[model samples]
Structure formats: C-alpha cells, structure tokens
Target: MNPWALSGVVLVAAVTFYLGKRSSRYANTTHDFLVARRTVRSRRNAAAISGEYLSAASFLGVAGVVLKEGADALWYPIGFTAGYLALMLFVAAPLRRSGAYTLPDFMEARLASEPLRKLCTVAVVAIGVLYMLPQLQGAGLALEAVMPAPAWLGAVGVTVLVTVNVMAGGMRAITVVQAFQYWLKLFALAAPTFVLCVVFFGTGGAGSAGSLGDPAPPVFREDTTVTVETGASFEVSEETPVWLPAEEGGQRVWLPGVRYEVDEGTTLRFPEGAPVPAVSGGEMDNASWLRPAEDAGALLGTYSLIFATFLGTMGLPHVLVRFYTNPDGKAARRTTVQVLVLLGLFYMFPVLIGALSRMYVPELLVTGRTDAAVLLVPSAMLPGVPGQILGAVTAAGAFAAFLSTSSGLLVSVAGVVATDVLAGKVRDFRIATVTMAALPAALAVSLPVEDLSLSVGLSFALAASTFCPLLVLGIWWRRLTWPGAMVGMCVGGGLVLLALVLNVLSEYSGGWAPWFIEQPALLTVTAAFLATIVVSLGTARRIPDDVNAVMLRLHAPDPLGFMRDRAEARFGRIEDRSRKRGKHRK
Candidate 1:
C-alpha cells in the first residue's frame, strides 16, 4: 500500500466529515436543510457548484478521451463549459426568480399543476440516479490508484461518506464541502501538471513529447507492463514481441508477435517503442484520432454529444438546486459567471494530462483501461518519492471529485424523495438520503465499469431529452400547458430509456443500431421540444389564468417586491402599502 495515497484519502475524508458536522448545527429547519435558507454568497456558491459539476468524468474521463481520441476529444470539455453558458443565458436568473426548491417545485410553480409537479419530481430522481452511478464507479478507479482493492470498496466508501455528510446537513453542509473539494481537485491536478511539464519539456527530462500529427498509432515511449483485468479482444497494428508472465508461479516466456487476445489476469510487458494495440471495438491511427469526425456515425455522435451537454445543463437537478441556495436572481447569475471561470480553469489540467498521456502512458490503450491514465501518469513520468507523492495527490483529488459530485446528487435526489415521494418532513429527508444512495451503490459494485465520460454523456443525453425542453419552454413560453409538459418529458425521457435498453440488447446480440438511434439525443431532444410545442398549441385554452402575473414575477426587476410565490400559501407575505410604510424605518 502507498502510505501517501492512503493519507491523502484520509485527510480529505476527515476534512469532509468535519465540515459537514460543523455545518449541520445550523440546518434545523427544512428550508435550511434544503436550500441553506438561500443565504450562500455568490462566490462560495459558485465554488460549490463547480465542485459538484466537475465529477469523475472531468477528473479522469476527459483525459481518457483525449488520450484515446486526441483532438476530437477536445469537444468534451468545450461542450461541458459551454453548457453553463446556456444555463446562465437562458435559465439562471429566471430559474432563481421562480422561487422553487426543486425542479418539481419549479414545474408546479410555473404550470400550477400538481400532476405535472409529480412527473417532474420523478424525472429529477431518474436523472440524479443516472448521474450518481459514474461518481461511484470513479471512486473505484481512484482507489485502485492508491492500492489494489475490490471495486465495491470505493462505491461503499463513497456511499457511506456521502450519506453521513448529506444526512447531517444536506445542501447547507455539502456546499462547503463541495467548494473545498473544487480547490482540492484543482491543486491535485495542477501540481502534477506542472511537474510533468517540467519533466517532459525541460532539459534533463523525458524530452519533447511525440508530435500529435504522427499518422501511426501511439507507441510505448519506454518499456511498459500492462495487466488485463478481464478477457478482451484488441488488435495490434503490427507483429511485435512481448513478455508474458506465467500463471501459477511458472517461468516467464517471450511471446513472438501478434498478441491479439488476452484472458483475465494476463500480464504483458512490451519493449520501448512497440506499437500499443488498440481496443478491438474501435481502433484509429493518430491521424484519424487527431481529426474531428471519422465517418457519418462518429460525426453524428459528436453533434449529439455537443447538443446533449449544452442544453442538458438546465435539466441537471443537482446543478439547478444549487441556484436556490443563492439569495436572488442576480446572485445566481453572478454565481454562474464565477462557475464558468472556475470550470474553464479546472478543465485545462485535464486536457494537459490527456495530451501528455498519449506519449507517457499508452499501455492503457492496449489494456482498455484508458480512464486510469491520469492516475498512472504521475508515477510513470516522475520516479521515486516525488512521483509517489503526486500520485497520492491525484488519487485524493479523484476521490474528492467523486465525493463532491456524489454529495450534491444525493442531496438533490433526497430532496425529491422527501418532498414528493414521502411526507416532506425533516425525518423523511434523512431517510431519503440513505434510500437514494443505496441502489446506486449496489449497482456500482455489481455492474461492469464502462467508459466514464460515455456513461456521463448518456446521462446528459437523457436529461437533455427530457427536462431541457421542460425547463427552456417552461421558463420562456407562456402557453406551456400541464399536459404538454407531462407528455413532452415522458416522451423524451421514455425515448432515451428505450434507446438505453436497445443499446444493451444490441451490445449482447452483436447487432448495434445506427449512431442516431444509439445516441438518440439529436433526435430525442427535437422530439421532446416538438411534442411539448404541439401539445401545448393544441391545448391553447388550458394556459394558466395567472400566466401574466407569474411571468411578471419571473421577468421583473428585484426591487419591485413582487411576491415570491403569490399563488402558493406556504410562505407568508407583506401586504398593504400604507401599513408597510407606517411600520417601515427610514
């Protein structure tokens, strides 16, 4: 076991628990627990939002994609950062002005329909669950960098940590934890990046990284050993010799050329400058990898990916819930601005690691575990104690990414379950935290780990297909009817889920559908928007009577003293201008 790596994990956990317990003291009421009484400041809330937004996919998967796909993978981070731009421009101020605690609350408030609110609550939970799975899987990958352990350990550990922290203080507590984690993740990534740059670019180091324009596949920069965790098929570009470790403590043997297949637990050592075999399912030379689109199918997937991430931000329940923690519409917008800057800064390090990994850690390509590139690179580049220390730091940051995002997701999930599924009580929220995390933890431990970014992108596609339209239309369009919202979300969410099922079936049956059908966002998002519009236009007479008043509340400046929730009786209000003037101090 690497003590430094283990220590970093312990340190982060200690800090998280300490902050959570400290914050829990003030979160006595439901409002405080759910939205931090809307007292979080712009900068602090932005940090927390950034923390939660940069999940395992950003920490490891972005670099993994870059290492594998090269220039084309640049779109992942671009799409991710661009998403918040959409959120800020279209949804941020307006959503905050709506005075809703959850996405369901927003729906019900906007449409004045209880049935539609219930549907939204269900969608929030579904998206939260979908997003949570990657965080848990990322936890497993992070732990492996520290020490070899069962996949279940990381999932269970993160679940318990998230549950304890969330159950203690909810959003109020997690805001602080997530904010701290954002910086921690930044430092974790930035430090290694600096050292690697010096080692790779500076004199007396590894020398210049290989040119990106090379047409050949990435080769081992130095002799490397790669262990295949499961039986898998991948193709080697050329005949190459390799050293294979024998089973049952037998002697090692030099295998000549064309090692095309590997079984579980197979360990193969390659000589320096040997071609790194590409994964069997998809293989590309450096020239193709560097380019944006390969063919019709890949080009379609790229468009779908960008579309899903950009529009999908509004649909993410965890992200939108954070805006409620801001005091007003302006604060939410300011928070978004800060979030954009912080996200832009954090994303740079991932691209650096990914680009460098192409030269430094190509064994991952052969192993089909490209996600481990960031975790493995520090030690691979810098030998001895320095590498170990950096490795530990990277591992800690990875864990923090998992915990930070998972905490936010758990809070959002618990909010829906407690408010919509249960009695909407403090006790119910506490119960819901555990209940929401339990299923995902179990699934994370049992299920096979997929591509982290791909899994997360699918969650984005699902959200984009469903709630993106619900949100964009609900906020902008006055004619949106309850039936329209319901039909649109259901149709959109249903199609994505159907595509997922089809994807599974096709994967097992070896009969995958075309790119649009498998990816689905490009088509599904359009379908949802059309469905909502068509249904609402057909049911034009069903618009809420107070649509004008609600629109005034949403669009009006903050000083007007328009009601927070004029139609809802849950919150009290100030009334009578003469009486208020008489009671008012200068």
Candidate 2:
C-alpha cells in the first residue's frame, strides 16, 4: 500500500463525511430530505448533478473501453452528454414543474393512480441497484490496483461512507458534497492529463507503433512482469519466454499459434519490444478498434448503444431526482444546460487518457482489465515519487466517482423505499439507506468482475425501456391513463428484463444470441415507446379528470401561479393522509 495515496483517499472520505454531517442541519423536514425544499440554485445543482452522473463508467470504464475499443467507444461519452440535451428539451422543466419528490411521486401526481406509482417504484429500485453495482465493482478494481487490501474493501468502504453521509443529510447534504466532488474529480483527472501531455510531447510525442486490429500485436515499451489473477487460455502472437510459478514447474519458451494455459498467480515476464498476447474474450486489434461498426452486427450494436444512452438519461432514478432539487421549471432547464457544458469538458480528458494508456500500459490489455488504464498509465509513464502521487490523485478521483454516484443512487432508492414501502419519515429514510447501500455492496463483492461500462449501459437500456416512455408521454401527452401507463411499464420493463436475463444466459450458449443480448436497446427502447403510445391511445377515455390542470402546471413557467398553488395543495393533502396513516399504524 502506498501510504500517501491511501492517505489522500482517506482524507477525501473524511472531508466528504464532515460536509454531509454539517449539511444535516437543513434536512429537518421530509421535503428538505427529499428535494431540499426545491431551493437549490441552478449552478450548484448542475455541479451536483454532474458529480453524480459521472459514475465509475465515466471515471474509469470510459477510458478503459476507449483504450480497448478505440473510436467506437467514443460513442459512450457522446451519448452520455447528448442524453442531457434530450432531457433539457423534453423532460427537465416539466419534471420539476410537476413538484414531485420522486419518479413514483411524479407518476402518481400526473396520473392520479397509486398502483402505477408503486410499479414505477419497483422499476426505480431495479434500475438503481443495477446502476450501483458497477460503481462498487469499479471502486474495488481501483483500490486493488493501488493497495494491498482485498478488492472488496474499496466497495465496502465507499458503501459505508456513502450510507453515513446520506443517512445524516439526504439530498440537501448530498448537494453540497457532490458539488464539491465535481471540481475535485475535474482537478484530479485534468491535472494529471495536462502533465502527462507535457511529458508525452517533451518525450517527442512517440505513440504506440502497434496496430490494434491487424496481425501486428501491441509491443511493450519496457520489460514488464504481469501476474495472472485468473487462469485463462491466451493466444500467443510470437515466440516469448514466460516465467511461471516455480511450484508449477519453471520458466518455459512459448511459441506462436499455440494456446497457453496461464494458471492463477502465474507471473509472466516479457522483454521490451516483445509482442503482447491477446486474451480470449473480445480482444480487438487497432484496425477493428479504430473502425466504427466493421460488420452488420457491429452496426446494430452501435446503433442500439446510441439509442439507449440518448434516451436513457431522462429516466435514470438518480439523475431525475436532481431536477426536483432545482427551484423551478426554468432553473431545471438552466441546470441541465450547465450540466451539458460541465460534462462536455470533463469527458474530453478520458479519451486522451485511454489513448495514452495503449502506449504506456499494454499489459492491461493482456489481463483483459482495460478499465484500469486510467489508474495505471500515470505511474507507468512517469515512475518514482511523481508517478506515485499522480496515481494517488487518480485513485482519489475514482473514489469520488464511486462516492458521488453511489450517494445519489442511495438517495433515490432510499427515498422510494421510505416513501412507498415504509412510512415516509427520517428514521425510515435512514433504514432504507443502509438496506440500499449494503445489498449492492455485498453483490458487487461476491459477483465476478464484468465490464463496468457494459453493465452501466444495460441499466440505461432498462431505464430507457421503462420510465423513458412513462415520463415522455405523461408530461406531453394528456391522453395517457393509469391503466395504459401501468401496462406499458409492465410490458416494456418486463421485456427488457427478460432480454437482460436471456443475454446473461446467452453468454454461455454463444452465437447470434450474444449479439442481440449485447445491444437490446434498439428493440427494447422502440418496443417501450410503441407500447406506451398504443396503450395510451386505446385508453384515452380513461384519462384522469384533472388532466388539463396537471398539464397546465407541468408546462406553465410561473411557479407562483394558480396551477402551482393547486399542486402544492394536493401534495399537502397527500402528506396529511400519509401522516394520519402513520399515526394509525403506530
């Protein structure tokens, strides 16, 4: 363990906890706990939103994917930022104007149905959990790279810190902490990237000579030692001498065109300028990696990814909740605009980091853990004290990624659990926070590591299939009914869930199934939009009686108007009823 790096990470966590505890003073009411009484400024809320939105996928996984997949992977960040534009034009203002605390609250307020609200709550929890697992897993991967502790420690530590902060202050506290985190993350990544760029140019801007897609394999810049954590078969591109564990015999000469069984804990040494072997799964060369959609299947997958990410941002539980924190409809719109700017700036660095890693840390490609590219590259290129410090900064940024995103997810999930499942009280919120944080942390630790960005994209696809349709039609189309919304959510969410399960199963079965599973968004997202539209038109007669009033409130700009007052009155009535029910249960 590099004590300096570990100490930096520890200090970040400590300061985060203190910030949250300090903000707890403002979270005295249920309203403040959930949406900070809708008092947040546009700029601060924008930072907080960006902080939470740039999850492990953006912090680590994007660079890793770009490192492995090249230009095609650029779509990840493009789609991510573009999704916010869609949100700005369509969902942001209306969602905030609806004056709802959660997605479920929005559904119930819009359609006047408790059942659909409950159904939406289920979708929220599912998406939240699916989204959170990758964050925990990413944290673990990052910590394991820099420290001697078990991989699970990073996930557990983040979960605990996030839970404590969220339980103490909720959205109000999280807003302050997450806003600070956005700047912290930007500094951490940007500073190193600037220095690395200088170093690269100072060293004559020499890049990797290896082609990513051809017969030519990646060449190491220096003699390196690679320890295999799991046993796997690798294709040797050249005759290389590899060192194995003494217990498993000794060093042996490896030949080209032969598959080698690299046992767990086996250490291999490759001389400088030697060709790096490719791993078994989805290893692409520079030509294929740089090319966008080299085949019909690749084209479909690319389009599906674009479709999911472009539409998915509007429906994310954590992302949507941030809009509710804004002061009004216009503020929400402004916050989203700021978010696009901030995100656009932040995403530029990751791609550069990814490209740099291909030259500096090709060993990661052999291990099939390209996600560590951002964390590994600084030390590989710089070395010594400077490298250690830079590596620690990157690690701290990675932790901030986990902490910010997990905190947002926990708040959204815990809010739902407290409001819909338990009594909507502070104590209930605290309990739900623990449950939400712990369950995902446990799963992240136990499950085998998978592609972090891919898992996060799947969650986005699920959201696009489920809530995207609900929010789009609910806000813009007045004909939507409770039954239509419910059925659409069931069919859309259910089909995507089924597709996800089949995709997981197909990993074993292999063939065309994997292609469809890998990119179900094209089908699932389309099916969801169609299902909602068709069911809504068919149930036009069942539209709520107060549809005009709700629509007016959602669209109108004046926050102090009659429609706004009416909506607030309704919320007050609902709260009174909820409090009475709680008293009765007590």
Candidate 3:
C-alpha cells in the first residue's frame, strides 16, 4: 500500500484525462465521433493503431511468460506483431474503401439489406462486449498489484474515465490519447530495463557471480519431527528440515534436536549453504520415442497460437473500426504497413525485458505473479533511488497500456451498440454506451483475478468467431447475399458464444461434458466462413447488380470522393445529382 506509488499512477491517469478532454472537442458530428472525419494521417494513425493493439496483456503478460516458459513464450509477441502483416496484405484497403462507419454499416452497404445489417449489428455488439471485459479486468488487476487499492475500485474508476474520454471527445480525442500513450509506454519500459542492467553490472557481480550464492536450492521434507544437527550452519522452515555438515558453509548456525511443526504443501529454499561436490560425467545415451512426440507437441501448440493470432487479427472489431476511420483506401493501406513497422519496434523491448526477468527475477514464479515479473525486475536489479524511479516509470507504462486499450475497446463496443441498436438516438446511444461500458466494469469486479494473457485470449476467441468471417467475406466476395450473411453470422456468432459458455461451465463443473475444447478460433472461424459461402450459393440468383459496383469501390483505389460518387452512381440519376447540387447552392 505505497502511497507514493499509487499517487504516481493516478497523476499519470489525470494527465491522460486532460489530454483526452482537450482532443475530443474536434468531434462534433457522427462522422467525427465514429471515424475522426476520415482525416488522420497514416503515420500518427499507425502509432495509434500500434498503441491500441498492444494491450496490457501484451506488455505485461508476454514478459511473464518468457520468464517462466523459456523461449517458447516469445511466440506470443511474434504472433501478435505478425498479425498486422496479414492485415496489410489482405484486409486493409478493401475494408477502408467499403465506405462504412462500422462493420454493420459495411454489411448494409455490401448486401443492401436491412435484415443483414441488424444481424451484423447483433454480432458486433456481442463481440465488442466480450472483448471489453478483459480490458476492464486487466485495469483492475494492474491497479491492485501496483497500489494498495481494491481491484473493483480500480475497475470502476477506469470504466468511468474511459467512458468519459470516448463520450465527450470521440475518435479524435482517443487518437491523440493513444498516440501519446504509445511513446509513454515504450519509454517507461525501456528506461527501467537499461538502468537495471547498468546497476546490476556496476555492483561487481559480473562473470564469476556464482560465489554470491548457490542458486536457491530445492527444499524437501521427510517427516514432521525431522531435527537438524547442523555441525556448521542450516536454515529450516515449516515446510522442510535440512542439516548442514561442518564443511557446508564455514560456521555452525543451527542447534540440534529442536522439534518443530512442519507445514505441508508450503515451499522453502536453501541459499549458498551446501557446498558443491565436483564429478566427471560421460554422455548419457538414454533416448526415447516419447521425446520426439513431446518436442512435436510443443511445436504444434506454438503454431496453433501463432495461427490464431495471425488470422484472428483480421477479425478484431476494434482494429477493423479503426480502418473505417481512414479518409481513403490508400491511406488505410499505408496505415496498416506503418502499423507493422511501429509494432515491430515495440515488440523488441518487451522480449528483452521478458528474457531479463527469466534470469534475474526467478522468484516471481513462486508467487505466480509472473505478469508483474517485468514491472518488479528493475527494483530487484537496482535496490535504491534509481530502482524506485524505474519502478514508477514502468508502472506508468503499464497504466498507459491499460488506459489506451480500454478506451479503444470501450469506443468500439459503445459505438456499435449506439449506432446499431439505438441508431444515434441521443438518449438511447447514451444509455447503451453507459451500460455497455459499465457492465464489463461490474463483471470485472467479480472475477477472481487471473492471468491477463488468458483473459485476452478469450477476447480474441470472441472476436474471431463473430466478426472475422463477416468482414472477410463481405469485403472479398460479392456473391454473399443477405440471408447468407445473416446465417453465417448466426452460426459463427452462436458457436463462439456457446463455446465461451461451455468453457465457463466446464471451469466450474470440471468434467468432459463439452468435450473440453480449448482453442475455438479454428473451428468457429471455419464454420462461419463455410456458412456464409453455402447460404450465399443457395441464394445466388437474388444477388443485386449493385454488388459489383460497390465491390469495385472497396477493392480499387480512388480519391476520397470514391464512396460518395459510387453511392451517387448506384442510386442517383442525372436529375437527382442536379437537384442535390441546387440544394447545396441554396
């Protein structure tokens, strides 16, 4: 419960709030709120995109994984950064050219059906809500860990802060906030890591540092009353009893026959008390077929995670909504590539910190707070003022990560709920936005804190299931009909929701009732895609001729007026344009 630490976090948040308020005044209309009037340049927008994409999970969780799991954990960040690669190649230009404020808008224009729009809207809101929960939960967990505050309080506070930022200022405000937060987050981590390394090396523990201690030794307990007669020295805990021989350490530090109660299931470790016994050994030639399977199995797991991330990036609603905010298709494409570069740069630092945590702060594994492993590493490496300053900076970075990401998810969910369900009815949009943001905050309060990465993965599963197919097929395929889109959305959306529910139930009930499916992305995404294609084929004759025209606009490069012109060409005659022009003059 450090007041200074908590105050630092709150001060940083206050500054972010001020920046958001100042930036939001630019949003005056629905277009401004939804897409920043489609005027954001590619470079700044690219940084903003990277800022939103790298959530608290990526910042904090990845390092923890690397610390615990060795090189295998590096795959998470690789998959995350590589996701933008897939987007740049396939989804960027067409999605921006679709001339829609949101995915549901794209659906209405693409299929020319109010029914399909409604279905897509349903899926959008559902997935948005699911995705928001983890952001809220991450915020709570971060605040709880760094400060003495209760987790629920942090969750509620962040919900209010982000909701205000979005509702008051809209996309313009969020853009500025995210862009600024990205740099803040980067330096926050980078500064501490460098300082920690310098301090560690300067402490004269360079090469032959083994003399400092034998890596904390494993503790083993034989029975309850095992007494230690340390001829030299020893340390015993409730969990284990060990005796040190006269030659172990250099002095006798333990008394004999001191009976004590041993607490089972607890952990204890010995320091540099036991002397090493040198031995020469030959290569052990024991090999088994199981070894190959174990290695292959690990590789399969890594590939599965990477695959889910790459394809799943294309389907994320928040990410897709950002594309809709671009002024033109080319700008969107440029933004995508820039985002790749920005993310690639950001990924390098986290991997370095993760590796450092593995070597230096191995104790974090005992407490299962590997998520905070990076944040605490600097303090462990540098013990005084420099360490404290580095810790504060890292905390600020983590706070920035949570705030920027939560704001993005809040805007995405609230925008969808407002536009689709309420249709910009002021009162209803306000209510929907408030409720959408508030529900997750409340739910986050109830969660018994879990690893941030696991929760983020669930959010990805929801996004992949509901919106991935809708965006992919709607953009690339013209034959996709309204009924087909609706059916596909329902099947895909339904499977994802069902999978999530089954997962929760299985977690609570603990059995093989649902067949124990872990990764839902592959199956759910395929089902959605298949459903769209099948239904569209069955209803192919009902396809509208305007589909070809709209598809061209989405796929081809044109000026910013491309959408307005295509809209006019599809629905307006010469007389209609003249009438519109006349009205504009008046």
lDDT against the true structure, per candidate, is 0.83, 0.84, 0.66
Residue-level lDDT of model 1, residues 1-586, one tens digit each, is 6789889998998898998888777665576567876778899999999999999999999999998877778888998998999999889888888888888888888898999988888788888988999899989878876887877798899999999999988987888899899999999999999989888867444532355667877777777788887666666656555777655343333223333556777888878776777765454467766777768888898898888888888789999999987778999999999999999999999999997887777778877788988888888788788988988999899999999999999999999889888876678999999999998998898888888998998899989998899889888899999999989988998999998988878766544677876678999999999999999999998899989988887878777866383223432222332233232110
Candidate 3 per-residue C-alpha lDDT over 403-480 given as tens digits, one digit per residue, 9 for 90 to 100: 888777777767777777775633444576688887777778875555677667666666666666777777777787
**Judged by lDDT relative to the true structure, which candidate is superior, 2 or 3?**
2
Q: Which consecutive 10 residues in model 2 have the weakest lDDT in total?
A: 577-586
lDDT measured at residue 144 in model 1 versus the true structure, 0 to 100: 73
For candidate 2, report its TM-score. Answer: 0.91
Q: What C-alpha root-mean-square deviation, in Å, does candidate 3 show against the real structure? A: 9.1
Model 1 C-alpha RMSD vs. true structure (Å) is 4.3
Per-model TM-score versus the true fold: 0.92, 0.91, 0.80
RMSD of each: 4.3, 4.6, 9.1
Off by over 4 Å in 3: 2-4, 200-298, 425-428, 501-516, 565-586
